[model samples]
Target: MLLDKSVNHDEVLLRTLAGRNFYASIQTVVKQKSDGQLLLYGIIEDISERKHAEQVINELNETLMKRAQELESVNKELEAFSYSVSHDLRAPLRALDGFSRILLDEYQDRLDDKAKDRLSRIRKAAQTMSGLIDDLLQLSRITRVELTVKPVNLSQLATDIIVELQKEASEHQVSCIIQDNVTALGDAKLLRIVLVNLLGNAWKFTRNTDQAVIEFGVRSSETESTTIYYVRDNGAGFDMAYADKLFKAFQRLHSANEFPGTGIGLATVYRIILKHSGRIWAQSEIGQGACFYFTLGK
Candidate 1:
């Protein structure tokens, strides 16, 4: 029973009975009034189950946090290993490619036409291999490198990239357009690589088109966060049937004879987007055109 206001319970202590036969708590106090009197109140509750549940919850949370840390450590090791392999292998491979060319250049008269042709093919293959290795290294860096996101002027970025791409080769009259003043916070350099690859492909695929058109700009989706920037090109588009395989490493939509590439550019681009915690996808028809959609920022 709860005692009246005359009793004091704040000074109570949880304890057992004097005989140690049952669980209970009590307090003794003296009240001041016209007549001084002593009073006592007792109260108690069983907290064993609540204490056990709290301990269990703490243990489970600790285990989950440890597992998450372990997984993060594993991913770091894997990324480091990948970067090392790509960077280390490229040096000697370049030597092989260069020496082979030197052999052909100095000893052409000592060899037959077929031998010379085979040597040329070897050089081409080695160059392509070197390009593949370089792309892989870039991909690893994109994954492991720390991102310094800052407000970037998309207007200037696109203009500079398009100018450089035009200078890379002058054979094609590529039509370039920047449709919007897209701005966002992200790693400027990585975004440039993404743009270069996308624009390069647009320029490559539209070789057959007399008026090869490639446009870059901002795009909005229904949701605010879903807003993205994209590149669209009028090129020899691929079959929609194999769309899923387009971004996988070493996956190619066209024959090497028809188009020359290591088949890793799109894959690298995909990885960069993923590292930014963004999405990348493509839309294409057999011969119509292709549109590459990618998230540029948060």
Candidate 2:
């Protein structure tokens, strides 16, 4: 075919007579000389390795796409199951809590001391179980909600949350330091949840300190355009050995007697940050207090 053409460039995958594959790029040029004789030039370069690499990449891409689809399907099923479980338990919890409260209010005068105490215990247990149910639902919702990303004034958010916390616990005299103009790009709602959990933990752990101090700020990274935000507190810090369990669902570093919680807040925060393509970590010493650091990807 090249012998009949004046000038041509083509790439061909050829099977040699020896029965092996070879990819070759061919360039040909032909011109009529002054004496009516033809001049022919041809160049052929082997491109087998490049073609093989492209084939391998295409195969890898197909496999990755299939895996991604499967993961998405599995995640949807898990979310549905969580929703069902939480919904089923909520009705019973509400009934128990409502009945216990009613019995205590209407029958306290007729009931004995032991009976009243038993009713009180039932009420408290019902309330705690209700809280756990709510936390499970919240975790599931956060995991499944679509994120709405925008510029958020993180410092202002922290200040708002701190003010609310102070109002709720007016007896506690704590000093809070929030850096001005600290900001980031993320889902404002989800970021608020993260701050609420982190700041709430700081506040809870600091209850034993006479004059608790909490700080919220951002530090510039040396080699990246991203900022690292942190919440620090002078409080009852936990052992570093248990740090790995901090973000798992229903894992608590501190006992409920010391810090009353459903052990789901950190797990929720972790999911929110992960949805934002971010990272979160903590540093602490038993008595010196703790600092939590996080980054929202730019």
TM-score of model 2 (CA atoms): 0.76
Q: Look at candidate 1 and tell me the lDDT of residue 190.
A: 82
Worst 10 residues of 2 by lDDT: 1-10
Against the true structure, candidate 1 reaches a TM-score of 0.75
Clash count list over all predictions: 0, 0
Local distance difference test values of all predictions, in order: 0.79, 0.90
Worst 10 residues of 1 by lDDT: 19-28
Number of the predicted model whose TM-score against the real structure is largest: 2
Listing every candidate in turn, what is its Cα RMSD in Å to the true structure after a full C-alpha superposition? Answer: 5.6, 4.3
lDDT of 1 by residue, 1-298 (tens): 3334443333332445553332223344433454544354334444545556878999999999999999899888877787687768777777877888898989988988998888888788888888877787787777778888888776678788888878877877988888766876778888888888898898889988878888888776676666678889988998989999999988998998998998888888888788778998899997787999888545
Error of 1 at 106 (Å): 2.0
Q: Which candidate is the best by lDDT?
A: 2
TM-score of each: 0.75, 0.76
Model 2 clashing residue pairs (backbone): none
Report the C-alpha lDDT of model 2 over 31-100, residue by residue, as the tens digit: 6678877778888778899888999999999999999999999998988788788768778878887898
Give candidate 1's whole-model lDDT.
Answer: 0.79
